[model samples]
Target: MATWLTTFSYWLLIQSFVITIILLPLSHLLVSYLPLYLFNYRSHDSPSRYLLFITLFIPFTIIFLLITDLSHIVILLFFVWFSVLLGFIDHQTGYLPDLLVYPLLVLALLFHAMQSNEQLLLAIYGALVSYLIFWFIYGFFKLAIKRRGLAQGDIKLVAAYGAWLGVYILPYLMLLSACLGLLNYILLWIKIRYKPDKIAFGPALASAGIGLMLIKYFKEDWLIKIIL
Candidate 1:
């Protein structure tokens, strides 16, 4: 069983890498037709080739390493792919289209449903909780500061992440995302010596989601063990 698992892991790694390489160029064409908001249409530009390659490669490698179950790996590969797409779109156009995010939410719910009834319930709860929390924050910022703290697309993105990862992990996701955002802000300030009025939060959130997923994947071996 151990040997078989190792062999399977290697095979998946190779296959995923090859697929990523093939899909990199094709992604440029696909990005053109993405459902972007009217305002974003003017800013629709492709991500750099290096950025695209890194995005595809990291998720594939992480998912392949962390998931022992083949079915779980397949589902996560889909999740990772779409998360990257959303991140790319947000980075490029500062918009997260419902066309992509809603389908991802549906897929995450379906994936959890296949796992068990309890998991499905947790996913639903996560989605609702995440959305409501963000909605509250949005309202608070609007009323208190007279500015939008988060875009609607960002709220939906977190909700989708909740559906995929479960409610229990939402806090960690948020914390990690905030940390990443702060780091990004600091880096930009240092490099450019000027802070932009707006920063795309989706990429940081997506990155946090991915990072937490990897932690969850290896929890049994390392995280849980350490905690216990």
Candidate 2:
């Protein structure tokens, strides 16, 4: 069984890599134009070349990590792809479209259901828990700071992540996201010599999600041990 899983994992890694390279350019184009079509406003001034590099880099990295285990490859890939998409969109426009996020949530739920009813319940609980946590944070920011701290899209993005990764991973995800976000802020500040008024949270969260998935892929036994 382990040998079969290893063989299948290698095959999936190769297949997913090829597919990612083929689809990435198209994904970039879609990310570029879709918002314009839907909102009649260009989400970004122009797509950054660096964005293209990061976009291609993440899935390749994730697929490489998954080559040792295929247990969650399909769902993980789906989550990675959409997370990348939504991250790009949110970074550019400060919006996470329902068109992408809703489908991701549905896919997570369906995939979890395929595994077991218990998993499906956990996914649902994860979604609600994460959403409520973010919602509370958002409300607190509004009341305390007299400004929106987290956007609705960000809340939904976290909820989608919870649906896919489950409640157990939420604390790690949040911590990673906060750390990455701070790092991003520092880099941007260093580059521009001023703090940017707005920082995008989606990229950090997406990155954290990918990191967690990689951990699950490569250290499933360790994770299980820790959880148990």
Candidate 3:
């Protein structure tokens, strides 16, 4: 058990930090291609070449070193991959695509079926509840503030997190993302002063999702200590 816990923690760290950097520019390329196809832009750079290299090369190295259960690792990768993918698009376009979001829900359902029989119901319930929460919050804040504090895209992102991580993790992902966003906003606000420059929420979302997956596998005492 201890051995599994330690390995899982290391895996979480890699997914949040190392895998994020590894996937960064490649996801950027995905945005480039899909956008061009959607809008027919001529000047976009090719993001395909890097796509092949990152997906193939990095996983090869990680699996080579880890030599653990492939099923477990693949499940972990599913959540992190979507988080990075969403983050990349949010940074570039300021909107999350319904195209991507729906497909991801399908993938989450697939993951739910294969890896998590017991957990699937709770996860789905979380998704629906969180989706409503964000939707309601979006409207109320818009009415009260007379300005959009968060976007529908962000609600979809939060809903996705809830779907994949379950109700218990819903709060953690939000709290973690908010903390990181607060820190980021303060720093960026100090420097840029409400310029509406496209900031990256993807990384925070990805980081928080990763934390959700890993925290449960640790010893409870350590988890509580970290929370404190």
Candidate 4:
């Protein structure tokens, strides 16, 4: 029985890896085409060249994530689609647009509703709670501390995560993001001749979102349960 299971798993992994490799060229095309398609980035020739290199690194990530199930693959598809869109937007302009966020919100709501009552509620609650928490924090900090440290983009990005991950998971995600973000900030300070404001929080938010998504799918409950 163990031998059979091992053989089946190996076969599945090979098939999925093959499919992902075949898709790499297509992903390359998307990375290149995304800049031109996004209107604002049609003029920039260099970033697309770099993005193609980034696309090449994407396959291993795809294969690693695919080791789990089809649902995760679908989630990754959506995540990649959104990430590409945002990447283009960020590359062209200095902002992550509301245009993508609105559509994502609609799609997420529709997707959850189609799934079931529990999912719909969880998604909605996640979005609402995350948004409000961030919003209040931003406002309070802005008033009392007299500083605008956290960007609204970060708030909306976390709100978007609400549609995908569990409500409880959002807090953990935020905590993880804070820790990692600080580490990244310090690394950037030491390595790059750039300031903190030069590096946008949107990328950090994207990384955090990806990290949470990966942990939710790949990490076993016992790992989190024991840690928590």
Which of the numbered candidates is closest to the native, going by highest lDDT?
A: 1
Candidate 1 has which clashing residue pairs, if any?
A: none
Candidate 2: minimum summed lDDT over ten consecutive residues — where? 1-10
lDDT of 1 by residue, 35-54 (tens): 34434475435468788778
Q: How accurate locally, in lDDT, is each candidate? A: 0.80, 0.78, 0.63, 0.62
lDDT of 2 by residue, 1-228 (tens): 123244456555666568677767877886798778766657537677466656756666556544544545666666777888877877777777888889889988987898899999999999999999999999999999998989998899889889878998889888889999999889989999998998899889888877775565455555445842
Q: What is the per-residue lDDT of model 3 for residues 59-122, given as tens digits with 9 covering 90 to 100?
A: 4334324436667566556555665566555555556666676666666666677766777787
Residue 134: error of model 4 in Å?
Answer: 0.9
What's the residue-level lDDT of 98 in candidate 1?
82
Residue pairs with clashing backbones, model 4:
none
Runs in model 3 lying further than 4 Å from the true structure = 1-28, 38-67, 193-200, 217-228
Give, for candidate 4, the lowest lDDT window spanning 10 residues.
Answer: 1-10
Off by over 4 Å in 1: 1-10, 32-40, 224-228
Q: Report how far residue 106 has shifted in candidate 2, in Å.
A: 0.7
User: Residue 215 error for model 4, in Å?
Assistant: 2.0
Best candidate, TM-score: 1
List the candidates' TM-scores in order: 0.88, 0.84, 0.70, 0.69
| lDDT for position 69 in model 4 | 48
